[model samples]
Target chain A: MIYFDKVTKTYLDNLKALDEVTLSIEPKEMVTIVGHSGAGKSTLIKMLLAEDEPTTGSVYFESVDIHSLKRSLLTQYRRRIGIIFQDFRLLPHKTAYENVAFAMEAAGRSDEEIESDVPYALELVDLREKIWNFPSELSGGERQRVAIARAIVNQPDVLVADEPTGNLDPMNTYDVVQILKKIHDLGTTVILTTHNKGVVDSIDKRVVTMEKGKIIKDVKHGKLTL
Target chain B: MMTSMKRILRAGFLAFWRNSVVSVASVFVMTVTLSVIGSIIFTQVTLQTTLAQISDKVDVNVYFVTTAREEDILAVKTALEGLPEVAATEYVTKDKVYQDFRTRHENDSLTLQALDELEENPLGAILNVRAKETSQYASIAQFLETSDLLKKNETPIIDKVNYQQNRAAIDKLAAIIASSEKIGLFVTAILVVMSILITFNTIRLAIFTSKDEITVMRLVGASSAFSRGPFIVQGIMAGLSSAVIALAIFYPLTYWLAPFTTDFFSGLNLFSYYVDNFPQFFLMIMGSGIALGSISSVLAVRKYLKV
Candidate 1:
């Protein structure tokens, strides 16, 4: 569903975030990208999100060059993908329901759809009881769940979790991982980036390992390794 | 489309309330700027009215010789009245001038005695001339100097003209008012530019404070319209609230100060003036407030909205 054709990104001060890296992912696949802090994982995700342009070559979403689309079209295109972050990134003022509704609102979903889908999506993340709680009122795990609910509310085709469990406790981390596995079972292509070896061992999914700016290994049902 | 608009507007209001401190700070700055502008406008109106009243007090009086015939003086009056610059001309006979001099000197025994000592009503008949404009007085005086009444080959039908005696004060007043108006406009321009810059910076700071929220919005697949709408709305709210606040402050101020200003400035009622032009003032203050706020917000968020 996505392709990176020899993409390379170079900074002005001679830093290469991604160098001649080429990769692709199929549909309905749960893939984990394991990397150290400066292993070009964030840069790779930025290219996919079109938040940063590749210095050379191209990144494509379903055969369409992602960065070549105009701003308005890109926004429309982004609605097809949902992103989760380590910070959860929920609007501090909004309740869980409003936060999910916000994502649907951004996607131009109907009020009827938002009112109906928000609860279902919140229930999916086991946040139905605390749907009225603001981000500040929720625990880190609950906040991340709210973020996940927001991501899936629009029923995006692709789900991306960027260090989704980085801030959670052990139990919360397990709950989050299980939720990602459940989302994958529901047939959404899930691409998660994490450096946690324990989290990777539990998943037993496809692993793409990176070091520096290049991918070193790609294995189906793989274990995390340096 | 309708739902989207409602959502955007609601989100905008929510954003405004969510960032209440910044919103209040922006409104406060806006109120100060608008209040200053309003006060400047009121002062300009009051100053113009007072200057106009003062200008009316300035005129030249042409005194004719005591020996000059009443018909000759009447002819001079008719001719002076014919001039385009002369707004009015009134003939004051020697008898009336003597009477006026006596009445004016009633408080001083020495002045009354000196007036009485003048044998046979030595005071001359006078033609009081008023110009259409204060600046026209100089030309009117020059016109009179070259007139046949002043240079009558023999006994010159006119005596000394009192224009030179009053010219200095009138010219000085007019010059001062003109220069002050120029200065007032220059200062107003500076204030306007400075206020805009202040508002711009304040809004920039407000946006900078919200950068985290903006980034989250972008990351969650929010469009520019969705992300930027709240800030724009917040800005407009700040502007509108400030305008209302400024009006509330200025209305009472104008009313309370009206009596004092009327008394001090010969019945120039600022309260009435403000009330009469209230709709215009409302539009000006509110329109500028909204413009200042929205433009500043739009510009401040430009760099951050790239996502």
Candidate 2:
């Protein structure tokens, strides 16, 4: 579960990156945040990941105040959550399996656990056969799948994706959306941010629309509209 | 603890082997630094032995009174042996001294003729006294001059005391050895600093070259500690490899170069000594190289690896 209690983020010179906003989402829910460029959608995800802090409000995940978490505990907090980026961010030198196994290793999983879970996660992402391939040797969609395999490899409770399909073609976009749906069905809360109206219309899930740092609409079974 | 250490060490070693150029550079820097240090040690050892040989050549000579009987001078020689500072005392008779003079000047016919025409044995019966150190020479001379029967029993009075003859050369040799030690220390310090800087920059460039890889590792969920381990490992590897290389190069080098060094200064058989104590020399070269390499890498990574 995720909660934002009137959270506000102000940048240098009083530029409002995210205005006072409040929202909550339950576990196993799929929520899509949509807005044009310069809206607070990306800021919302950044705050959730603890990459940035709120200026005037507190954000909590599962009754635990995330901002109050000590610096040393940040790694533990991140281990239970997965973040997917538009860039893929796959290590170019690493094979797909190594990239995924690296996530488990970061969490300090035992070697046996890593060896067991990494392949399973890659299989879930339909990248098992391509696990041995490096990022430079993989296609765009496959690289994103490697990123997904790494994200879910640890079975993180919360999955936050920031415009993951922005660079993918339509077919690949459809495949990634399906993966998101599958992950959501398996009981992980999913938060996706995008400027794509078509993705919102297609998802038919809880949609939160932001405009100029404030959430203007929150709709269940939501449709995309300006 | 062992398991954890093994894990960390293996990771460190793996990280070192992962990057080629920077690791090689680190090894090279470490090798050069250790070699300079090793050579200084070798030179110091060589100087110490040479100084010992030179000191051995410096001994006190006492000429007895011409009127003193041979039995009385023999008594003086026996008395000299009782002193702790005197290592050895040899009695050179007048005839032997004359023969030594003629043999020494054999190359010059003029000096040989001068020694041949001397009527009496011009060289007196001399008591050659060697001390443990040059500093004890004055004390030995004073002791002999103050000794009882032999002190005033000389027939024509004492001819000459040769203890102070080579005093200046002995002092100069000692001063040169002391200054050489100071210079060696200063040169070693400078070389260590220079080598550390070179190794630090080389490792930094290695990290810079792989900056993108580090960034990617972080994005995927690597803790700063985990992400930083490999670079440190690379540094340690470079250090260890360089140490091995320096040892490999220096072992035979110490042997081959030892003889050449004796050409410049006699009584120093550096090559023979190291060849005889080969194990110790190997450890010295390799140990220093590895230590320097590992330390430099740890410092460099500590600065750059802070996320």
Candidate 3:
């Protein structure tokens, strides 16, 4: 239930990061956005996450227009959508369980709820055994899993995996892909962007390819045919 | 709101513990600020005590001529006593002055021989006058100067009339002390402002280091209000710690240091002064701590919580 209609994003330096791009995602669908570097893939998700605004057209998450939301209410809207970064931006000071619980805490979940749901979220990401380990103590695959746990901790309607497995080795990448597929199967809208051809082809989901600032192709039940 | 407040407070405490370097540094800055303020408070207390002591010893004694009639002089003393400033007055006859002087030196034979050789008593009759306080001296002196009954009557056989010889110097010193108080308060206020700025900048750096956590808080749904609480708490803790520390450091320092200041202020009872005003000093220390802590926290949190 997310839509972007004729969206154009211009950075402060007049960089036309995205231009006249129109796209929509229905409920419970997994869409993969594929592009090379500086291809506006990140800008697309950044707009949806309410981190950046469209320069010309509107971006909508469900019924609310993101561009005009006041600063106070913006966080309320953003916490509904989970995003995992390329760096696996888990708080280094926090343990795996605490990282997931941090999400619930940010959402103002009660102590009892955080205590219950954080462990459950970690278990889902197969990080139950690494719950007490800090990010530095964990392997790259495990840290990514911790990030996934934080992303899904609040049971967000949509998950944007912007190069979620970018830092992982092949085996860990495969593991992360399986986690995304499992999350998608459980009925969360999953949006992934990557130039990793192997992971993209293996997913066999709907794929959208971008070049410059425009959406070049959209294929359902498709390969990573960029 | 209640739930959020609890979260903020808990988070603030956790953050303070986790960010030890920043916390300790902030606390140290707060200590320095409070200590500076503490010294101001100490000076105010001791100065008041010294003023009170000066006032106790100060009296305006108007001396009359040796040739003045006892009756006329007594009448002048009565008139002087009528003035509102006069606390007490006594008539000192020249014979009594001579007699007391002879009794003291009579035991010393050489001084006794010199005293016997002098046929006439050189001492004038003294009007020993005590005023309400040294501050009342000017008004009392004004009254005596205007009293022709004491001043203009050659018939009264009056000669050079004078009060205490050292009143002028004492009065001048009192004026200097009063002016210095105003200047002291002004200087202390300036120092306070500088210290607060120092404290604010220090705390700001600590908050700046946690920029990533701040961004993460926003992404995870923490309100701008919630994110600010920890830094504010950190500032308050610094202030509070500074308050306690300054008192702990200053109390003993005052004890050892009071005696050293004897060179500048002879016979100053600084040790007793601190003992008497300890309550007031404690309050000042606490107030400085809270001010530095809360204001610095506000500055830091306000800047970073713009999300």
Candidate 4:
């Protein structure tokens, strides 16, 4: 579980990326954050990942202050959370299999476990055939699938997809949404941030909407009403 | 621990190979730096040997009066030998000087006939005094000027000191050598600083090319060590490659240059100097290259690895 306790982030030029936003996600829940550009969606996710510190109040995961953890402990805490970016942040130099294995390697997985699980992770994302292909050789959808495999290879407790569909075509976007749904159904908490009304409508789950720097709506079984 | 280290090293090698062009550029710059340093070192040793040879050729000659006693001349020789600055003192009798003058001008009929017409030997006994260093000659000459070898019983026992004959030329040569040495040291120091900066910038650019990989590594929960270890290894490799390349290039080059250097400066063997000090050169070049590479890598990658 993750909680944001009245978190606020203010930039030097008086830009309030996030303002007094309080939210929480329960275990195994699928949540989508919907907002226009500069809606403070990415800032909230960054706080959860401990990549940025809240200017006031605190963000916590399972009762531990995410920002206050020491560097070594913070790395350990981040291992329990998998993150995906819009750009499919895969190492270009690595093959699809190596990209997935990179996460497991970061978690200090054994060679035997890597040999067994990396293939399985790739298969779940339907990228088993592209295991040896580089990111340059794969389509946008395939690269996103590789990113998904890389994120889940360690079986982290929470998965954060920040604009995962931002760079994909509608077809690739739909496929990625389906894969994310499959991952959520398999019992990992998935938090997706996007502006696509279609993605929110397709999910039909809990939705949090934002305008400016504050959360304006949180609806259960929410549609893309905004 | 071993597994992690192996993975880190493997990752470093893979990254280096992946960015082969940048890696090669880094190596090339580092090789140039090492070679510059190596050449400066070689030039310094060679210059020192040449200066020593020149200094050995410099000696002050003192001529005694014809009426001066042999005992007095011997006393002056003993006095010059007693000075720590004086390396040696040789007493050349008047008869020997006359014979040397005749032998040197044996092909000159006018000089031989003129010497034959002389009733007595006109040459005085000479004392040749060598100083340990060219700069020390001034002090030895001053000692001769103030000593009683020049004046006894209100008459000068010495006829003339020939130090003044070649004094201007020797002083000019000494000044030139000293100034040249100072200038050489100054240029070498500037080159070293430039070498470090160039190596640093080259490594920075190479790491900047891999910026995305670094970000991904951190986002995936890789430790600081895991993310940074590869860059360190890559830097060491670049440094080591440059050093090896520089040595390979310089070895045969030194051989080709040795004969020319010997022709210009007798007994100055650069090839032999390189071989004699190969171990030291190896350590210096390799150590500097690695240090420059790794330190620059660490500094350049720090800002990007904050995640």
Better model by lDDT, 1 or 4? Answer: 4
Instruction: Please write out the lDDT profile of model 3 over residues A4-88, one tens digit for every residue.
Output: 9899998889888998999999999999999998899999988887777788998888867888899877888878888788888
Candidate 1 positional error at A135, Å: 0.7
The superposed Cα distance between candidate 4 and the true structure at residue B263, in angstroms, equals 2.5
Docking class of 3: acceptable
Tell how far residue A223 is off in model 3, in angstroms. Answer: 3.2
- For residue B9, model 4's alpha carbon misses the true position, in angstroms, by 1.5
- Candidate 1 DockQ category? medium
lDDT of 2 by residue, B1-307 (tens): 3433454566566556644555676677677776777676776677666767777877778886555567777888888888888899999877787788778888999977876686776666888998876667778888766777555533444666765686677667657756766886787688767766776676666667767666555545567767676666666567667767776776678677876777866846676776777688678766665565556556655554433
TM-score of 2: 0.76
Q: In candidate 3, which residue pairs get closer than 3 Å at backbone N, Cα or C atoms, i.e. clash? A: none
lDDT by residue (tens digit), candidate 3, B168-283: 77588658667767887788789878877787788778778877777777777778876667667777777778888888897688788788655455566566666787787778
Q: How accurate is candidate 2 locally (lDDT)?
A: 0.77
> Which is the leading candidate under lDDT?
4
TM-score order, best first, reads 4, 1, 3, 2
Q: Evaluate candidate 4 by giving its C-alpha RMSD to the native, one decimal.
A: 3.3
> Between 1 and 3, whose TM-score is larger?
1
Output the better candidate (1/4) by DockQ: 4
Ordered list by DockQ, greatest first = 4, 1, 3, 2
Q: Cα RMSD (Å) per model?
A: 3.5, 5.1, 4.7, 3.3
Model 4: colliding residue pairs: none
TM-score of each: 0.87, 0.76, 0.80, 0.88
Cα distance off (Å), candidate 3, residue A189: 1.8
What is the model-wide C-alpha lDDT for candidate 3?
A: 0.80
TM-score of 4: 0.88
